[model samples]
Target: MWLYAGRRIVLTIPILLGVTIICFALVQIAPGDPIQNLLSPTATAQDAARLRAAYGLDQPLMVQYFIWLGKVCVGNLGMSISDNVPVAGEVLHAFVNTIVIALISVVLAFVVSMIFGVIAAYRTGSLADRLITAVAVFGISVPPFWLGVILVIFFAVDLSWLPATGMGASGSETFSYFRWADFKFAIMPIIALALPPLGIMTRTTRSSIAEILNQDFIQTLRAKGLSEAQVIVHAVVNIMPQAVAMLGLQLGYLIGGSVLVETVFTWPGTGYLLNKAVLTRDIPLLQGTILVLATAFVLINLVVDLAQSLIDPRLKRS
Candidate 1:
């Protein structure tokens, strides 16, 4: 198991470097001059040249990439063009906000899916099963951005039960946990991010569990005079590794989907931050944010792989 984990860890180094290269390349080739943001309308040609030279924009692209890469290797992410602050610190702060929102969304999705999925499996073909299937289908089919808009219109506009936007009370800079207001602000975004994954997980879990029940082991256990509940408990335990694996994929979806959900709800997270960076064409900041997000997504899947190996020894062979 440790060997497998070590192998996975080693493999991730190249993948991360590849991601970094692609991120750097995309930013370099993007059409607009990043230095434009620094110039005033009244600035002279020398001012433009000076700013370009200062940023090393006059150098070869590969040289700039290697310089940036060197800084990244030494725990420096450089500075943001938008605010002139440390890019690493800003990205880390944004990551914290994103994790809080995304993790909660993931948990909610997992719980909701497992419960409904299990019920649908147990009730197979009943009215409850049909209703669950319908709702799960609807949840999966609806786009998060559209759903978020509808929810904002209904709850925030018409009902006024929840705030339409923002991470917390007005003018708040950081989120404080355990505060009802903060959680209150997150509710809609959470729901928007959670629904599609919840639906997919529910469908998959139901199908997987149902398939597991048909296996010879399940029949043997039943023949041994185990109660239905006992048989189900056994099935659930056997299915946990599958669930863990599926959760990892769903987590990736949550992170990707956050860009849309955060934008619709104006939640102050990395996704929102990325949107701002793009609009402002802040290349240094954009590269840093994407790199951090990609790293997080990769690390999460690594944990999932390790967890699956721990839960099911058979996976270690693969």
Candidate 2:
């Protein structure tokens, strides 16, 4: 297990390097000059040149990338052009806000989908299975952003059961999930983020579990006089690695893809930060946010691989 883990860790080094290259390249390819947007309309050519040189924008792409890479290695993400602040600090602050709700959404989806999947798989052609399948299909088909809007209208505007947007009265710093006042603000965003993943995972789990149940080992277990529940436990264990992979993927999506949901609800997360950065063409902020999110996605997959290896030692042999 340790040897497999070491190999996986070593493998991530190149992937991380590639991720950095992609992040840097994507930001460079994006249209518009951030410095032009930053400067006043009446600013002279020398002013623009001086500002560009100051930010190292005047340097060659290769030189700029190396400089940025060096700073990143030491935890400096450079300065945000729009905010005039350290990119690391801004990204870190927003990342914390995003991760909190994202974790909650993924865990909620995992537990609920596990139950739904198992039931649907066990029942196969029954009405219960059909109903669950229908719900899962709806989840998969619906756009989270659209759902977020509907939820905001129904719950926040019409019923007034919850606040439509923002983290809470006090913002992310003072917000507590334990407090109803703050928790209510998260419900809609969580629902929006959770639904798509719940659907995908439910389908994956149902198919995997159903396949496991049909295998000869399951029949052997049943022939040995094992109860239905015990047989199900075995099947669930057999499908866990796949379920965990889906869970990790969903979590990564929630962390990085919540821009629309976050925007709808005005949640101060990395997604919202990304949206703002893009609109303003805040190059440093955009680059930093993308790098952080990409790194997060890669790391999530690494953790998922390690978890799969632990659950099914056969994975290590591969």
Best by TM-score: 2
Q: Rate the local accuracy (lDDT) of all candidates.
A: 0.86, 0.93
lDDT tens string, model 2, 74-180?
Answer: 99999998989999999999998899899999999999999999999999999989999998999999999999999999999899998999988878888899999
For model 1, the superposed segments whose C-alpha errors exceed 4 Å read 170-174
lDDT of 1 by residue, 185-260 (tens): 8889888888898889899889988888889999999999999999998888888898988888888767755888
* RMSD to truth, every model: 1.7, 0.9
Model 2, runs deviating above 4 Å: none
What overall lDDT, based on C-alpha atoms, would model 2 receive against the true structure?
Answer: 0.93
